[model samples]
Target: MTSAISVDDVHFAYDDEPVLRGVSLSVEQGAFLGVLGPNGSGKTTLVRIMLGLERPDAGRVELFGQPAETFTDGTRLGYVSQHSTDADATMPVTVREVVTMGRYAHAGIDRLNDADHAAVDDALERVDITDIAGRRLSTLSGGQRQRAYIARALASEADLLALDEPTVGIDADSLARFYDLLGELNDEGITIVLVEHDIGVVTEHASTIACLDGELYAHCETSAFLESDALERAFSSVRVANAHRPVGGD
Candidate 1:
């Protein structure tokens, strides 16, 4: 299968602290790959390297069979960034308008044409936000806004979908829905690259699992990788206990 996103011996550093050290991985076409790691483990840095937003100190990063620098921007790769730009108060632009912005990479500030409008409408429907398509983005609940961001990526129609902590701020129900939709997209030939903190939920759907701790610590298929030493090392501090303590009783 063709690889949508590939990195070979990628090394990155900020000052003296090394972020990525010989990090090598690949997201196969139509596969869902998850990046699991701690806060300072270089998850975002890897995403930036893939997007060509940050230059890697060493090694190579390739996207769609070409060098990362070949593509000027993320037209071929769609991204759902970590933070939602605006959430408080209210904004004037409707949900549809926000989604239409995804096509900006291709349209470049032009008015939405027939194809763009259809893409926006379809994206809203895919994320199950069609009912609120006309409503202002800021008026929606936390989950709704998260769905809107996913819709934006859907509208972009990129081959590779990279999400960084997309489930943040979303409720349980919406998070489930988001993952389900991503699976559907992956089945339809969209390669998904996810950097998520939550392990249980991500591993459940991702076909391949990758763990990073300031480098490409672990990269392998899901079942094998999850059981390997890399998984334990990447989540060394991550603990999810079955036994719960009451408000004050442990």
Candidate 2:
């Protein structure tokens, strides 16, 4: 299978503090990859680098075989950040309007044509948000809002979707439904890179796991990762580091 993302010995930091050190991994096409780590382990930062939102300090990253920085096809990539669930109540945008934004890249300066509208409709249907397409985004529940976001990605025909802690404040039933939607998307060949704190859920859903703690401890099949000590090793390192931190150190 082709590689959807390739990270080669990437290093990054904020100011003088190091976040990632020689981290490397590859996500194959149609694969569901779960990025796991303890708090402050650079999981979100790593995903940002993968999506070209942030550049690596000392290594390279490629998306769909092109250097991430040079990959100009904006329609092929979709991202849902941790804060995506919190829709501002003041914004008057409706669900359909939000999803329609995804086609802006393809539509350019011209108005959305028939094909674009069809894509938007298909996406809304795929995520089962067609019923609420006209509802105000702020009026929807967390799960409904999330589904709207996913439909936006689908509308753009994104091949790679990167979500960072997307289910943060979602209820249990909603979270389950969200994961089910992700499973269906992955089955349809969208490469997924998920940064999630829920280890049990990730283990059950992701095809592969990349365990990290300022470095790549393990990158392997989810089953193999479960059988190894990578999780314990990574989390233990975080605990050890925390034990020696100065008072009030961030």
Each candidate's number of clashing pairs is: 0, 0
Q: For candidate 1, which ten residues in a row score worst on lDDT? A: 237-246
- Write model 1 residue lDDT over 1-250, tens digit each, in one string: 6578788899998997788889888877888898898777789999989877788999888887778887666667788888888543455878887888898887886766899889988999898889998888778786788788889999999888999998888888677778888899999889899988888877889999888877666778889886788866665633212122245655
Q: Clashes in model 1: which pairs?
A: none
- TM-score against truth, every candidate: 0.87, 0.91
Worst 10 contiguous positions by lDDT, candidate 2:
81-90
Give model 2's clash tally.
Answer: 0
CA RMSD for every model?
Answer: 4.9, 2.7
Off by over 4 Å in 2: 85-87, 238-250
Off by over 4 Å in 1: 86-91, 109-111, 237-250
Q: Candidate 1, overall lDDT? A: 0.82
| Highest TM-score scorer | 2
